[model samples]
Structures are given as C-alpha cells and as structure tokens.
Target: MAEDGAAGGRPCPICEEPLYKRHCKYVCPQHGVIMDCADTFWN
Candidate 1:
C-alpha cells in the first residue's frame, strides 16, 4: 500500500491545502484541478 503524505501533515504544492484523494491522484483546488491523466487538455 502507498502512503498518504497529507496524513503526515503535508500540504499541496500550489494551494498549500491538505490534499485529498479525488480519484487516481491528489487534488488541490488551484493546482490540480486539471487531471494529469488526460491527453488533450486545451481541447
């Protein structure tokens, strides 16, 4: 099993908020609103 970094008091890089798992990755409102898994982003 992987470790939850935020559980140890880590903050998201951009928003500096507690990161919660949204789907496959962690989400910070200002930082990760764009899902990194997608291929066509601007489209």
Candidate 2:
C-alpha cells in the first residue's frame, strides 16, 4: 500500500522524516512548517 499524505515516501524538510499534514500545513521537525516553500524557494 502507498503511504499517507504524499503519493510517494518523502521525509520532512526540517526533521527529515515523514511529513504530517496537521491542521492546514505540512509540518516538519527541523523546519517546523514546510508551507510557503515557493516564497523561500530562491531565498
């Protein structure tokens, strides 16, 4: 079976672990929030 949330198995950016879709954002351990990535893509 496939993993939850993501179509493939991808870890969080901050935590480098599985991403958890909490509330309305993709939360990570080290990064905390993975949202607004586009805004900081170049930064």
Candidate 3:
C-alpha cells in the first residue's frame, strides 16, 4: 500500500518507480523501505 504524505518524487533504484518519503524515510511500493538503500540514497 502507498504511504501517507508520500507525494512521490524520488524513484526507487530497484523498481524504478516513485518512492514515498515518510518521516524522512523512503519506502518502495513493492519492497517497502529497504534498509540497504539508506546509504545509497543519502550518499
């Protein structure tokens, strides 16, 4: 399910779809919030 306040902006590197930022965190619709992606995203 889509996250609340997740308007869509950054695309997920894996799915290539828009990711939702909730509480300064990102979540993929298929995979949910990937912990490994944290470093890649912030860096």
RMSD of each: 6.4, 5.4, 4.9
Kindly report the root-mean-square deviation of model 2 from the true structure over all alpha carbons.
Answer: 5.4
Clashes found in each candidate (C-alpha, N, C closer than 3 A)? 0, 3, 0
Q: Per-residue CA lDDT of candidate 2, range 2-42, in tens? A: 33344233476555676655544565655666763345552
Error of 3 at 19 (Å): 0.3
Q: Residues 1-43, candidate 1: write the lDDT tens digits.
A: 3254343233566667765555445566567643332535422
Residue pairs that clash (backbone atoms under 3 angstroms), model 3: none
Clashing pairs in 2: 14-30, 14-31, 15-30
- The lDDT leader among the candidates is 3
Q: Which sections of candidate 1 miss by over 4 Å?
A: 1-9, 33-43
Better of 1 and 2 by lDDT: 2
Model 2 residue 13 CA deviation (Å) reads 4.1
